[model samples]
Target: MVLEEAYVDNQHNNLENVAHEMDGLLQFNTDRMIFFRNGMQSALETPLDFMILRKAEQEYISKRHEAIWSVALHNRRTLPVYGVSDAFIDKDPTLSRDNTLSGNELMATLELGYLLRLTNNNRGFTERMLYVSRSGFFVSTESANKHHPGAGAL
Candidate 1:
């Protein structure tokens, strides 16, 4: 089912609080699925469906970009953050001029790059896919967990 307006409203109101809570989850190396689920559970009195929870998680990730950047920045021993947009600049001539790009487009592009860098690069990993049904957006965590052990497990 599509997310209720109240739920989305509540999440938006609690964005910063949720982002801070997510830091603790990150410390424990919690899987993204579990982190999102728990984050929603903590934020709202009502339990949301998995699809709604996933959307909430995406929202949280987008809102928490600065927090994510801070963590990555402080951890100097971690993998070097690659210049993902730099590659695109060379490939797409239109993207070569910084003045032509809007602020929103640059931020969105950088966020996409950050997400790609945040994700595991292992060859055999099965990435999560969104399945749209008559019911709504469904991602089968059971199958995902089967492919990647302890993936959806809390």
Candidate 2:
């Protein structure tokens, strides 16, 4: 109701102020708008499928968060990830569009484990970090150790 009244008021005022406000919003978050529009389009295209996929992804994330990793025994372990979507985006927009469409199906599958370390010696795990790619691929650096001068052997 308030929005309708505002629309009417804006219309009466030639929508100059409302247009300016909209311009400000778009300028501030253009990339966010793109993401929002894409999401809306996907939802509209396949509401049920999108909801189911999102629910599955949420469940996976929840399970991961609930999982308890023994840091004492497992200093750094590689956990396999299944069905990871893999694709590369070209820097040139024209070349990318001509070669492949956006949001294409993943070509290959690979098992990549995320390296997790125990920051503190406690029952619960905390202060954990993992390096991941934009497409959610974990980059493990367990074997590769940095050597510093005056550092004792581990």
Candidate 3:
């Protein structure tokens, strides 16, 4: 079935896809077949099907982040990348940069799921792919875990 609404079950809290990936799963039932038009390369190799689950749901912590990572090596053969860590932090909240917040604290209007690993490069273990379904803005929220001892631990 082509459902544009959120499909909820005891197993899942959010079943509605929040992003329209240039391509994403839409349908694949009985015959279990689905095809989508792509420019040149195909992102989906195997067919995916939804499940009618009835498992119990429990407390789970959710987290997402949108930040750019830049590293510069001394002649491409050094560590720490010399002061790159400073650049990794979000300085301008006016830039509407939301970095360190638990999922519940996040005012995200969309949900993004990613694999545990994306690729490997230059000591970079695994990256992630984020698909923002709708346009949204972020205002960085201060984390209390840094100030108080276990005030708000995720």
Cα lDDT of all candidates, in order? 0.36, 0.34, 0.22
Name the best candidate (by lDDT).
1
Per residue, candidate 1 scores C-alpha lDDT tens digits across 1-154 of 3569888878887997888888976765556656445544543443224453344334433433231111122221122121222334446554342433323333333233233333334332246422221211122212334433443331
Model 3, range 1-154, lDDT digits (tens) per residue? 3353434342253333333321253332211222112201132332111110000000111112322211211221111100111223345332332334322222121111111111112133224222221112221122224323543433
Candidate 1 TM-score, true structure as reference: 0.20
Shift in Å, residue 120, candidate 3: 7.8
Q: What TM-score fits each model?
A: 0.20, 0.19, 0.16
Best by TM-score: 1
Give the better candidate number (1 or 2) by lDDT: 1
In the range 76-96, model 2's lDDT, one tens digit per residue, is 322222212222323323222
Error of 3 at 40 (Å): 11
